[model samples]
Target: MRFIDSHCHLDFDELADNLTKYMSDALASGITQFVVPGISLAQSKSLLAFSQKHPSCHISFGLHPYFLTAHSRDEMALLADLAEQNSEQLVAIGECGIDSQCDDLELQQALFKSHIVLANRLGLPMIVHHRQSHHLIAQAFKQTPPQFGGVIHAFSGSLQQAQYYLKLGFKLGLGGTITYPRAKKTREVVSRLPLSSFVLETDAPSMPVFGFQGQINVPVRLIDIFAQVCQLRNESEDEIAQALYATSCRVFSI
Candidate 1:
């Protein structure tokens, strides 16, 4: 039952305060590896430090759409420089992409494009953060596609949208959100999507599952997500786990 959380914010406040204990718990719960995504420059350093301290942890550095205000014109250059200098340490380029929920659609798209270019140049996967803007994100992909395809972290979209990303050679990140009964569309997409195009994630300190309502999410809870996904797809736990592990290895090159 070994597993990998393809996306998480381990540098986030909820997990940062006691990462050692959290990592221990996650290990006990079968999460052997994790990918910590950066939201801004500050978070990127924090993620790097965490990964440096923990052998099982990996890092992805980029500016998130939600934190568009924090980005500067030179930030992309800095990110590219950091990627080149620490290419071995960094696994991918993201928690970055478009989010229409935030007002700055144009700016977010611009920054996302910059990240795509950087990822292509560096030959690293791009972990996309699409929210209420899949169409726009798809359009951006068309303009400047990724060389090393990545996942749509915490996907919540229609089956058609899932197909689009699959056609583009991107994996869909499945997390606790699909555990909720109200996530009908997401569950449908999950059931219909091929196992090869799916990867597990927690997005820890957010997107908590049903039973852990009101509590901060964590990688250990990915087991619950795995079980839910198994039930939805009517597959055995071992089958789902192995498929997801293979999918993650393909996406992250681990």
Candidate 2:
């Protein structure tokens, strides 16, 4: 079964070194495509360089809520320019969204809005990052629905929230979160979610699978996540794989 890691941080130093080795292993393990998201303008530059080096790696440009202070108006403008300049190279408009845990909620909301607007203008999808702020994201969707749709990466939200995003034309990104036994709610949601509403991701160097928690995440682990997904759902391996592959392709316009 072929797969795509809908989210990963291949530009991070930990993964960047010997990236070729990791990419080789991931390809061997059946993960054929990857989407690397940007949190800062600098990271986006590095990500673009990496994407240029690797044909299978696609990129998304956006400012993460956690790094809100790191970038200013100029950087935001730079991101928009980069998106416009590299329209064909970009797959989405984010890794951007509200994180309730962060300070300056108002600022985060404004930044997120800009990202959504840019995405809509660019006619590209987005890769949203949500943590304790589904209501804010839902509210934004109500105000201005995604023009090209998007994905809620590393989603561990309730089925109700999943349905809300699905209603807004967003796909749920399933990753290592489903591998943990304590994630009963998310696992159950995954079990029943429509295949079309789901996409696979590893969030490499971050959301490691249950047993490999301390280890740095790599795209090759997409296979193990897929194993857990298979256990939770009724679909056959080939069916699940094909659906996920098509969903990623459709959402990102790859």
Candidate 3:
């Protein structure tokens, strides 16, 4: 069955330099399309260049919270201008959101709010990144729901949090995080959630699967994540695969 990696950092050096090699492995493993997210302006440019070279690559442009300090007012303006100019080139509006584990909660919130506004304005979905800041992100969704709903990438939240996003018309991105037996809570939530509300991702170059911890994750590992998802859910592999492929397509318009 064919698959799509709904979230990945193919712009990173490790993956970018060896894209042909990893992409070959990924294709062999059934990953046909990749949604590459931009964490900063520079990275977004790299993603654009990469996409130019690979037709299978889709893009998400945003200012990630982790790199908050690196952004400035000029950067934000440029981001908006770039989005307006290259709207057709993007599938979503993020890689942006609050991270409770990080400092400057207020700044993170402000940046996230701006991104949500941008998503709405651009009429595109968003790929949100959340850690311990579910409440804040949920509140943002409640206040200004996205017109083009997106996914909570790498979701490891409770059923309630997952439902909160679903209620806001979002899908949960299942990735390597679910492969670990230690992630019982997330795994259990994945088992119970509606298949329509789920999408598969690998978050490549990070979030490696259980046995490959500390190693750079690759898009091909999306197959292993899909296997864990199949084990968690009651659907057959083909059913799960089709459902996730459709979900990613619907969310990202890929």
Best by lDDT: 2
TM-score of each: 0.96, 0.97, 0.97
Question: How would you encode candidate 3's per-residue C-alpha lDDT over 1-254 as one tens digit per residue?
Answer: 99999998887887767889999999998899999998987787677788999889999888888787745446767887888889999999989988988878887787787788889999999999999888898787777767777989899989888888898788999988899999999999989988999999999999999999999999999999989988888889999999999889888887
- Tens-place lDDT per residue, model 2, 10-36, is 878888678889999999988889999
Q: Per-residue CA lDDT of candidate 1, range 28-48, in tens?
A: 988899988888877786666
Clashing pairs in 2: none
lDDT of each: 0.86, 0.89, 0.87
Displacement of the residue 177 alpha carbon in candidate 1, Å: 1.1
The local lDDT score (0 to 100) that residue 161 gets in candidate 3 is 82
Better candidate by TM-score, 1 or 2: 2
1 against 2, candidate with superior lDDT: 2
- Model 2 lDDT, full chain set: 0.89
- 10 residues in a row with least lDDT, candidate 2: 65-74
* Cα error, candidate 2, residue 18 (Å): 2.8
After superposition, which runs of candidate 1 have C-alpha atoms over 4 Å from their true positions? Answer: none
